[model samples]
Each structure stands twice: as C-alpha cells, then as structure tokens.
Target chain A: MQPFTYERPADVAAALAAIGKPGAKFLGGGTNLLDLMKVDAETPQHLVDVSRLPLAQISDEEGGLRIGATVTNSDLAGDPRVRERYPVLSRAVLNGASGQLRNQATTGGNLLQRTRCYYFYDPSMPCNKRVPGSGCSALKGYNRIHAVLGASDACIAVHPSDMAVALAVLDAEVEVQSASGQRRIKIADFHRLPEAAPEKDTILGNGELITAVILPPAPPGGQIYRKVRDRASYDFALVSVAAVVETEGDRIRSARIAMGGVAHKPWRAFEAERRLAGAVLSDDAFAAAGEAAVKGAVGRGHNDFKIPLAARTVARALTDAAAQKKA
Target chain B: MRNTSVTRRGLFGGGAALGATLQSGSALAQSPPPGAGAPPVDVSLKVNGAQHELRLDPRTTLLDALREHLALTGTKKGCDHGQCGACTVLIDGIRKNSCLNLALSCDDLEITTIEGLGREEALHPVQTAFVEHDGFQCGFCTPGQICSAVGMLAELKRGLPSAVTPELAAAAMEVAETEVRERMSGNICRCAAYPNIVAAILDAAGKA
Candidate 1:
C-alpha cells in the first residue's frame, strides 16, 4: 500500500476541511479501502478517518430508524429493534462480508463498497471504472460477475452490496453534509448507474460526509433478504433479492423489491412490485413477479446462468417474505 | 482521544515525534507516493492489558502492528484481505479483522488476541474444548479460530441471531449445531475440520 497521511479529525467540520485537499478520501471502516489500496486500485494520498466520529448511534427519528453512517455492521445487524422491525436490513447485512469484517465495516462504508468485479480490482487490467476511458475488461474477458441490468459502453460492473438492496426496498434516505449545508438524498438517487461516468460510484461530492441513513417506518408486512452465492459462506453474491410484502389475507396489498449483484446499482424491481399488488402471495404469483423483475436483463456468455438463477432467487425471496411469521 | 481543542497528548504525539521519525527514520515507508505522509505517526495501543506505544506508517494494518511491531504473533494472518478469519482479534471486546483495520484508526481501542485468552496453567474454556474435541488439524488457524469463538460466544450471549436461527424473537438463541456452523462460517478451515470446530464451540457455549 502507498503511504498516506492519516487524520482523525475532531468534528464533522474538521473532517470536511481536512479532506478538501487533493487526493483525500474519507476512511470509514477501512475494509474495502485498504484492500483496494493494497491492490493499487485506489491511491488516496490522505485518509480522513471518520470511523471515530460521534455518529455511531441507531435511533428512531425522522419517522423511522436513523442509522448513523459509522454504525458498525455487526452492531446494526444485532440491534434488537432492527431484527424486530426491519429484519430485511439485518438479514442483508448478515449476508455480506464475514463476521470479522462486519464487526469493523460501517453502514455508510457498506453502501459505498465497490464492485467485486475481478477486472476492476486488477490494476494491470483495463477497467473503465478504475480508470476512465481505459475500456472495460469484464465486457469481454471472464465476465461472469459483470452487470446484467445497467451497462453502458464504458463499464459493466455490478454493485456488490446486499444491505443497499434491502435499504432500496425499505425507502431509505441518506443524510450528508457539505460546507454549504446538510442535505437528504433519497436512496434511489444516491448511487448512479454506469451510464457515462463509471468512475464515480455515488452522487456524494468530494468534500461531503454522510451523516446518517434514514429509513422510513417498515411497512406492515414481512421482509426477507435472500442471497445466492457460489459458496455457502464468504463469497460475493451471484444474485440477491430483498423483498417485502403486506398481505390482506392471501392477496398482497403492497410489495417492494430490489436486486443486487446484477446491476451497476441496486436494481429496484418496480415491475415486480406492480405485478404483486392485488395478487395472491402464491408460488405462481412469485414466479411471474420474478420473471417481470428480470424482463430485460442481458447476460454475458459465462453468466447466462445468472438470468434464470436471478429469477429463481427472486421467487425464493418472495416466498420467504410471504412466509414470515405474523408480528 | 478527541482530535479537537489540541489535547496535550495530541500535540506532542503527532507534531514533535513526526519530525524526528521523518528525518532519522527506520525505513519509513515502502511505497511512498509523491504526496504521501513524510513522517511516521505515533499511536498508543493496549494489547492484553499492556499499554504500548509505537511510531509507524499511517497505512500499517493492525494485524501487521501486532505481528511485526509488537511481536504478538499469536494472531495468524491467513488471506490478509479479511476473507479468512485467521487475523481475527477482539477490538474493544468485539471480534474484528485486524488485517482490515489500520493501526492508526484503533488508537483508543482495547485489543485482545489469542495470547490474552488464557495462561498456561489455566486455559480458557474454549481452548480446553478445542483440545478435547481435536478441533484443529494443521493448527495454523487455531489462534484466530479460538479468538473468534471467544468473541462469538459474547455475541450469542447478547442474543444475536444467525442466518439459520429459526426464531428471531427467541428469549435465548439455542447454540444448535447448525447455528454454530452458520455463526462460525467466517472462520474457514482449509483442512475441513468444521465438524470438530462446531462441536468444540457448542461444548464451550454449553459449558458457559
């Protein structure tokens, strides 16, 4: 890893001021950043450590759960209220990384984690997301884990976050701070697809720091986060789904769905949600909704399996959500 | 530990020693980018109840600091990239990957490695269970496995649920065999000694 200045700023203002310089990056859990640095994929000259900031609490505010950006993944997953009220968020976080990594990884860092694309992490390979205009290696070379939903000419990498998928379905919003003032950005607008610029992952400005993630009160229903990976443990998702459904007797009153490991960002399954409304929460309904979710999903040679696999995973998630016990 | 108001420890620890380390250095940085920090940063850590201070590069990982700087080699480093739990340690009583943690970021944290688990005369219950069950084969991953088990038990004591946990609202989650496997899935053993490892953890949790 390259040498870098480490600053533990006192307040949010100091942290913002310190990172205003060039080649500076906010150091959140250091799990993804350090691993990327070790591979020479990212070389930030200054690290503004924001993990120690006094913003690690999870409280009920803003009409729902207000999760501080620095709240450790383990803490978030283990919080009783979260398990009781928003099981999807807890389950999604538990599905990610490892126990040791989750203990250190923070909520905001998990949202900002980069893709697990093999080509993107390789400095020797030409990845447009790593270096703009360099051409995407995953576009043609060993592209099993490349994006299936959103892909521009420049990049085809998937966003590797299970928690973000759940948050997307839960109607979450991010609270951020810049010199001007604090702002709230909806979860859907926080992450951008690789349409033109693949280098920038989130809409967060250089000097801005994420303060908290505000989740609206969970809908009256069951929630489930299901991930399908190569291995039973410690592997990135091939396809994952976060599904929440409110049923009026056997018919679904409302539904929210989002997918991960198949797109540049968490792909909201709006069509599936629309199909689910006023439908029975049955196997046939789930299967059709799953098909609707992946309607236009394209696949590379090796990952052509993911198309059907994604549909199956979606169906499984919906079934699991529907089977969730009455609270 | 507050960085604002220029606490006395902060001023002396960062400003004074930084110049000395930069000038009369000990092979300061390996791959120093042109704009990287020129001076080594001073950090204080309490490992196994002993307070130790060292000046190291800002990028040094907590695992390297333990193995290299402090010579506490009990914590093993497997796949350095947080995938394998061989580098697991207790940071402020929570299990975390030391390899993924920067030493400078853990200034005020209290760390517990395998060495801190127990002494020779009296072994930690988990260590005893591992030995009784023959939980390891190569023994390379034992330190981390033991440390992780200790921390995991604490998590379970607080009623954290695993993926396989059937009842989320259960008063106290049962440490069933499958629950043990799901909880210990992060600590991968290339030797495939999972059966014994799970048994040993279940025994320890049962004993506790």
Candidate 2:
C-alpha cells in the first residue's frame, strides 16, 4: 500500500473543506478504498477520515428515510425502520460483501465502490478503466464477471453493487455535499456508464462528498432483490435483479425494475417496467418483461451466459414480488 | 476525482504512542519516511483492554497493526484483500476485516481480537462450541470465523435479518440452517469444515 497521511476530520465542514484538495479522499469505512490502495490502484496523498463525522444517523423523514453516509452496511441492514419500510434496500445490502466487510462498509462507500473486474483490479493487466487508452484486457480475456449491457469500447466492467439496484427501483435520492454546497441526485443518475470514462464511477466532482441517501416512501407493492451467483455466498453476482410490483388482482398496476452485475450502472429495466403495467400477472408476462429488460444486451464471449441468466433472474424477481402476500 | 494532494484531521492520542512503538519488534520507529509515499505519523490504538500508541506509516492496516506493530499475532492475514475473512476482528464490538482497515482511521475505537475473545480456562461460548464440534482443520481461518460468528450472533440477537430471512420485519428472527450458512458465508474455510463450523456456531448459540 502507498504510504499516506490520514486525518480524522472533526466535522462535515472540516471534512468537506479538507477533502477537495488534489489527492485527498474522504475515508468512509475503508472496506473498498483500503483494498484498492493495497493493490496500488488508487493512491491518495491523504485520506480524510470522515468515519467519525457525525454522518452515521438514519432518520425518518416525511414519508421516507434519510440514511447518513457513514452508516455501516450492517447498521443499515439491521435498522428496523429500514427493514420494515424499505425491505428491498435492506435485502440488497445484506446480499452484498461478507459479515465483517458489511460491518465496516458505509453507505457512501458502498455507493462509491468500484467494479470487481478481474482485469481492473489486476495492476499488471492493461485495463482501459484503470489506465485510459492503455487497453482492455477483459475485452478478449477472462471476463466472466464483466458487463453484458451498456458496455462501450472503452470498457466493459460491471458496477458491482446490489444496494444501488434496489435504490434505483425505490427511486431514492443521494444527498451530496461539496465546496459549492449541497445537492440531491436521483439514485438512477448517481452512477454512470463506462462509455469513455470507466475510471470515473459517479458524477460527484472532486471534493464532493455523499452525506446521505433519501429513500422515497416504499411503493405499494411486493419488493424483492434476487442475486444469482456461482456460490451461495460471498460471491459477486452474475446477474441480480431488484423488482417491485403492485398488482391489481391478476394484472400488474405498476412496477419498477433494475438489475446489477449486468452494466456499468444499476441497469434500470424501464422497458420491463413499461411492459408490466396493466399486463396480466402471469409467467409468460414476466418472462416477456424479463426479455424486455435485456433487449439490447450484448454478451461478451465469456459472459454470454449472463444474457439469458439476467432475463431469468429478472422474471424470478418479478414472480417473487408478485407472489408476496400483503399483510 | 483525479488524484491530488490534500490533508485531513487526525485524532491524536497523547502519551501511549511512544511506548507502543518501542514495544513492536519491527522497530517501525525507525521508518524515516525517507523515500516515496508519506512519512510515519504518531498513532494511538486501544486493543482489547490495553492502549498502545505508536508512530506508524499511515497506510498500516489495523490487521498489520495487531499482527505486526503490537505483536498480537492471533489475527491472521489471509488474502490481505477483503475477499477472505482471515483478518476479521471486532472494532467497537463490530466485526470488521482488519486487513481492509487503516490503523489511523480506527483512532479512539476499541478493537477486540482473538486474544481478547477467550482463554483456555474459560473460552467464549463460540470458541468452546468450535472445539466441541471440531470446527476447524488447519486453523488458519479459525480466528476470523470465530470473530465473525460472534458478531453474527449479536446481529441476529438484535433482530437483524439476512437474505434468507423471509420477513424482514419479524422480531427475533430464528436461526435456521440456511440463515447460519448465509450469515457465515463471509468466512471461507478451505478445509471444508463448513458443516462442522455451522454446527459449532449453532451449538454455541444454543440454536442447534
């Protein structure tokens, strides 16, 4: 790991003011940042410790919840309010990382986490995302974990976040703080595609810090997040789907769908959502909706299996949500 | 966020750093930060029940600080990366991968290691359970597994749900086999002691 000076900021202002300096990064849980640092992938001159910056609060708002940036993954998953009001959010978070990692990973850090592309993490490999224009080894190498949607010539790394997928479906908002002040970005727009700048994950400019994520009221529907992977646990998703659907008798009244491990961002299935509306809640309808979700998906050789796998996972997620018994 | 130089606030603990630095066998006190990277800074860490302050390079991970700086070698380093759970330890009573944590970031927080878990005479329930069930083989991943199980039990006790838990709002979720496997999924046992490990944790928690 590159040697760096670490400071524990006293408050948000001090953290924000100190963070925008050239090589400084706000240290949240250090679950991802430190791992990246050890690989020499992300070398910062200084790490502004914001772990103690009073951002760990999870408060109830009008009809939603405001999760502070520093709220550990475990806390978010365990919080009763989150579990009852936003079960999908809690489920998504629980499916990610390990127990110990979750205990230390923060909400903001989870949002800011980079992809788990084998080539990207391998310092010796020529990954365009790691070093622009160098070359993309995953394009022609072992990329079983690479993206199958919204991929560009520059890069094809999938955004490895399950929580982002759930948040996208819940229509959450991210509260961000910077030198200019505070702003809220819709969860759907928080993460970007790896079109030309795979190196950049989110739109937060230099010195911008994520303070909290505001989850809108849970929709009137059964919510579910299903992650399909090789192993039962501690593994990244091959294809994960977050589905929330409101059914009017046997017909779908409304729906929201998003997927992970399939694209550079949490791939929102707008097509699927549109298809499911007013459609009969049947296996065929869900299968079609799943097909719509991955319509433009082009699978790399190594990940070609994901196109159908994603479609199936999407359908399964919808089925689970639809079958959810209303209490 | 292109890389640029910036400074941050550090929680400085007075008095103990000198003593801890002198105590480490590596003589880390000698790293002058002569070339490359940042120089070593004073760090104060409270491990188990003792406070040890030392001057260390800011990049030093809590795992290294425990296994190297403090010479508390019980916390093993597996995949220095966060993928493996060998470096699991309790920070402020919460299980965390010490390997993925920076020592400096943990200032003023309490850390519990395998050393603090239990001794031979009076082992923690989880530790005794592992022994009773023969939960390990090579023992490389035992410390992390134990620490993580302890944390998992506490989480369940707090009504924390898992992916397998059907109802997130259910109070006092039961510890079923699937729940145990999913919650303990983070700790990988190459020795395939999973069944026994699960049995051990279950027996310890009295949920078996």
Candidate 3:
C-alpha cells in the first residue's frame, strides 16, 4: 500500500472540506479501499477518516428508518426494526461477507465498493474499470463473473453488493453532503451501468459524502432475499434475488424485484414487477415474471449459465416470498 | 506499560543493539530504513491491556503493528488481505480482520488479540475446547479461529442472526451445528479440520 496522509474529521463539513482536493478519499471502512490500495489498484494520496464521525445512528424517520452512513453492516443487520420490518435487507446483509468483514464494513462503503472483477484487482491486466479507456479483459477473458445484463462494449463488470439489491427493491434514498450543499439520490439512480465509464460506479459527484440511507415505509408484503453462490457460505453470489410480493386473496396485488450478480448495478426487474401486478399467484405466473425479469439479458460465453440461473432464482424467491406469513 | 513511546529511529537502533547483544540476525534487523518512504505518523494502540505509542508508516496494517512493532506475534498474518481470518482481532469487542485495518485508523481503540485472551497456565475456554476436540492440525490458523470463536459467541449471545437462521425476525436463536458452521465460515483451515472445529465451537458455545 502506498503511504498517505490521514485525517479524522469530527464533522461532516470538515470531512467534505478535507476531501475536496484531488487524490483524496473519505475512508469509512477500509475493507475495500485498503485492499485496493495494497494491490495498487487505488492510490489515494490523502484519506479523510469519516468512520469515527457521528453518523453511526439508526433513527426512525416519519414512517421509515434513516440509517447513518457509517453504521457497520453488523449493526444495520442486527437492528430490531430492520430485522422485523425489512427482513430482506437483514438477510441480504447476512448473506454477504463473513462475520469479520461485515463487522468492519460500513453502509456507505458497501454501496461504493469496487467490483470484484479479477481484472480490476490485477494492475497488470487491462481493465477499463480500473483505468478508463485502457481496455476490458473481462470482455473476452475469463468472463464467468462478468455482467450478463445492461452491459456495454466498454465494460462488463458487475456490482458485487447484496445490500444494494435489497435497497433497490425497498426504494431507498441516499443522502449525500458536498461542499456546495446536500442532495438525495434515489437508490435506483444511484448506481450506473458500465456504459462508457465503468470507472464511475455511481452518480455521486467528487467529494460528496454519503450521510445516510433513508428507507421508506416497508412495502406491505413478505420480503425475501435469496443468494445463490458456489459455496453455501462466505462467497460472492453467482446470482441473487430480492423480492417483495403482496398477495390479495389469490392474486398478486403488488410486487417489486431486483437482482444482483447479473448486471453493472442492482438490476431492478421493473418489467417483472409490472407483469406480476394483479396476476393470479401461481407457478405459471411466477415463471412468467421470472422470464420477464431477464427479458433483455445478454450473456458472455463463460457466464451464459447465469441467465437461466437468474431466472430460476427469481421464480424461487417469489414463490417462497408469497408463501411467507406476513407480519 | 502505558504510553511507552518508540520512534522509528529508536526502534531500529534498539533492534540493532539487541541483535548485537544476541549476535544473531533478527527480523527487525532487516527492516527498511526510517527515511525510505512516507513520514512516520504517531499512533497509539491499546492492545491487550497495555497502551504503546509508536510512530509507523501510515500504510502499516494493524496485523503488522501487532506482530512486528509491539512483538505480539500471536495474531498471525495469513493472506495479508481480508480473505483469510488469520489476522482476526477484537476491536471494541467486535471481531475484524486486522490485515484490512490500518494501524493509524485504529489509534486509541481497544484491540484484543489472541495473546490477550488467556495466560499459558490458564487458557481461555474456547482455547481449551479446541485442544480437547483436536480442532486443528498444523495450528497455523488456530489463533484467528480462537479469537473469532470468542467473538462469534458474543454475537450469538446478543441474538445476532446468521445466513442460515430460519427466521430473521426471531428474538433469539439457538446455537446449532449448522449455525456454528455458517458463523465460522470466515476462518479457513486448509487442513480441512472443519468437523473438529465445528464440534469444538459447539462444545464451547454450550459452556459460554
């Protein structure tokens, strides 16, 4: 890791000012940033330590919860309100990295973590995400974990966050602070596809610090997050699904779905949700919803299996979610 | 000792003097010069029960700080990345991978490593359980596994849920075999002693 100057700012104003310069990053949890630094993939000259800032609280908003950015993944998952109201988010956080990593990873850092693409980690490899316009080795070389949807010729790296998938279904909003002012970016518009600029993962401007994630009232239904990985535990997902289904008698009243490990961002299945609305809850309808979810999915050679896997995951997640007893 | 200060220059000088007294090559004798890279930053670490003030390169990881600087070698460095749990330590009673944490970021935090768990004569209960169950083979990953188990039990006691927990909204969960396996998935034993490790953890959990 390159040696860098460090500062721990006590307030958000100071933090934003400290990171206003070039080659400066707000260090929340060093789980991803430090790892990237050790491999020379990310080399920031100055670090403004914001992990110790007073943004670790989880407070109840009007009808929802506002989670501070620095809240550790463990705390967020263990929060009673989250587990009771947003079990999908709790399960998604638990389905991520192991106990140790989750204990150190922050809510904001997890959203902004870099892709797990092997090419991105290796400095010698040609990765547009690591260095824009250089080249994308994942396009043709060992593309198993590459994106299968919303991918472009420039890059195919997928976002490796499970929490974001849940957030997408929950309609979470990110509160950010900058030197100029404050703004809120809806979770759907927060992350971006790998169109031409894979280096820019999110729409967050330079030196914008994530303050909190405001979740609206929990969707009125049974929520579930299902992750399929190579291993039973402690592994990244090959494909995952987060689904919220509300049933009225035997018909689906409303549905929201999102998928991970399948696209550059958490792929919100808006079409699938539309197809499921007012449809009779049945295997055939669920299968059709799954098919609608991957309508435009295009897979690279090594990752073609993810297409079918993602469809099945969506169907299974919906089936289980529909069967769950609502609170 | 509390607040024992060790500058980069003085640390190297002390290493040279100690090497000369022993007349042998030492790990510290081969370290890079103080003037090589970035300027050292003052970091105070409260490890085990002692607080030591040392000036370290900002890039130095907490794992290196424990093993190399403070001479607390029980916290082994396996992958140097967060992939392996060999660098696991308790910061404010929560287990974290020390390799992923910078020494400067951990200033003034309470860090508990394996050496702080128990003395040689009186071992921590988790350590004794590992011994009784033969939870390890080569024992390279033992320190991290032990520390992780200690922390895992604390989490379970506080009603933390795991990936396999059937109901997320449950107030509390029973520590079962599957729960132990899922919770300890971070620590990898290359020897494949997972059965014994799981058994020892369950036994310890019963006593915890």
Best by TM-score: 3
Per-model DockQ: 0.37, 0.41, 0.44
Which prediction has more favorable TM-score, 2 or 3?
3
Screening candidate 2 with a backbone cut-off below 3 angstroms (N, C-alpha, C), the clashing residue pairs are A7-B9, A8-B9, A8-B10, A22-B4, A22-B5, A23-B4, A23-B5, B17-B53, B17-B54
The alpha-carbon RMSD over the true interface for every model, in angstroms, is: 4.1, 5.4, 4.9
lDDT tens digits by residue: candidate 2, A148-265: 8999988999999888898999999999998898999998889988888888888888889999999887789898989998888888889999989899887999988999999999
**lDDT (C-alpha) at residue B73 in model 2:** 78
| CAPRI rating of model 3 | acceptable
Cα displacement (angstroms), candidate 3, residue A27, comes to: 0.7
What is the alpha-carbon lDDT of model 1 when measured against the actual structure? 0.86
lDDT of 1 at B63: 93
Docking class of 2: acceptable
What DockQ score does model 3 reach against the true complex?
0.44
Ranking by lDDT: 3, 1, 2
* Model 2: per-residue Cα lDDT at residue B47: 93
Q: What is the TM-score of chain A alone in each candidate?
A: 0.98, 0.98, 0.99
| Residues B1-208 of candidate 1: C-alpha lDDT, one tens digit per residue | 2225655545654764566447543442334442355488899999999998898877788998998678788999899988889999999999988999999888888999999989988899999999999999999888989999998898888888777777665658777887777777779899989889988999999764
Q: Which scores greater on lDDT, model 2 or model 3?
A: 3
lDDT of 3 by residue, B37-145 (tens): 5788899999998998898888889998888788787898899888879889999899999999999999889999999998999998999999999999999999999
TM-score of each: 0.92, 0.92, 0.94
lDDT tens readout by residue for model 2, B19-117? 545654552233222245577788889998899888877777888788766778789988999877888898888888899888887878999999999
Candidate 3, residues A10-106, lDDT tens digits: the string is 8998999899766899898999999998877888889999999999999999799999999999999999999999999999999999999999999
> Proportion of native contacts found in each model?
0.65, 0.82, 0.75
